[model samples]
Target: MPALASDVTVITITRRRPEILLRRCVPATGRQTRPVDHLIVVDDCPGTAERLSAAEGVVWHHASRTPDDMSGPGRSSRLRNWAARQVSTPWIAYLDDDNEWQPRHIETLIEAATAAGADAVHSERNVFHADGRPWLEPIWPWSADDAEGRSLYREMVRLGVAEPGRNVIHDRVDPLDIADGIRMVDTNEWLLRRDVLLELPFTETLTDVHEQGLLGEDDLLLADLVNAGVRISSSRTASVDYYLGGYSNNRLRHQDPDFAWR
Candidate 1:
């Protein structure tokens, strides 16, 4: 295999929404303070790589077949691994088809990593509905007092952040916990150790598994991470906008109180 390229890699696994992924999401990432080495666009759509080539920082990859569960089933993990394996960066960031980071998102993650002395650091997010509705304000707590911050139990009770779908940053640890059953982290916002992720792939069995009708791949991944004794620190400084597309019609048991945070 060729030596992995130098620089941070921002990997995106996309299907159908080429316009949004390439035009909006990719460009926004292009503006990051830490210039991305490559934007790996894993084309989940048939023959979408050619069109995806139009984006500036994109390096397109294709899977042999389409995934059974679009929500999670090995899609993000497979894409991240495939893209990450090519780049020799110490850090790898994941973004989904519909999500976009703020320009400062990467910078913020880098800053938080430097400050906390953490092996992995994850940021919070703002969510939006497809019809331009303000679905949520930033929901995670942001106080130095751990007492004031929402614990995993509180988030689970309210159903805020469980999926491996949020942003995260991680450094090199021998094996990554991508397969545990209970998830307390979101992978979309995660920065991971490129080498570790390359070794332990996401659990296809856990991907898109239904828990009261909600997908639980991300949650399971976190449970695995914590079990591995990896140090994870979370703060609100790094954040992203989770665009709720029309296709994602899964309803939350509660929405109003879930959006309200102290």
Candidate 2:
């Protein structure tokens, strides 16, 4: 019954990391605690569908060229917004190129949001370095009840949650109105309602920056959502393990902020 309660669709935006897609992201969904309606992997790279499809229970959305045949944050963000449109489920969960989800991640988010009477839900991310080192746990911890963690000013001032200046995190709160009644969250660690997400599209302008351009599109998106009256809920149960890699000699595969996502 729990499995049939909601249809969860995972939108994994990827480029030329087929091996990681098959080895990590693919298997992670198979181990999900709830039923996954579909797994859509948007292959922004050319001629990579066969490789991405090697994994079972996977559907591929291969795009020959990005919005401008470009490579960078915009490419991934464009693909993510596209894939979100293809899903028929009521819920959508996003996973990055290098990150993978835990077995109970989706199910936990579903249960938490449903129980908390929230329109959207997000949780902590367990950060892991490329050398397999643990940097921190529960990257951002917030209260369970909306009333407790609802103030945009309070959160921005103390928690340093929405660093709008950095553009890494955006608060949905309106600059003029403090009490918009919407909820905000960490995009990497959340599951969103399908209908609600369709209304909030990622910015294409931010995607066109240089390789190392700093922008908190994700943070800004969440802040805007919360400020718009979307109820945000946080939980410890729903989480993902993010791989943090060091800059190596290999320029082709060096994991830096240039390749790191928003």
Highest lDDT model number: 2
Q: In model 2, which runs have C-alpha deviations exceeding 4 angstroms? A: 1-6, 136-185, 207-213, 245-262
Compose the digit string of candidate 1's lDDT tens values, residues 80-106.
Answer: 556766777888878776777888888
Q: Candidate 1: which stretches are off by over 4 Å?
A: 1-6, 44-47, 66-72, 136-183, 207-215, 246-262
lDDT of the candidates, in the order given? 0.56, 0.60
lDDT of 2 by residue, 1-262 (tens): 0122348887777766777767777788778888785455555565467675565556767676534455445555677777777767888887766767788888788888998887778776554555556643323223333454346335554544433222123323233455543334445577888888788866545532423433445655675575577877766542677665312112343344345432
- Every model's TM-score: 0.68, 0.70
The whole-model C-alpha lDDT of candidate 2 against the native structure comes to 0.60
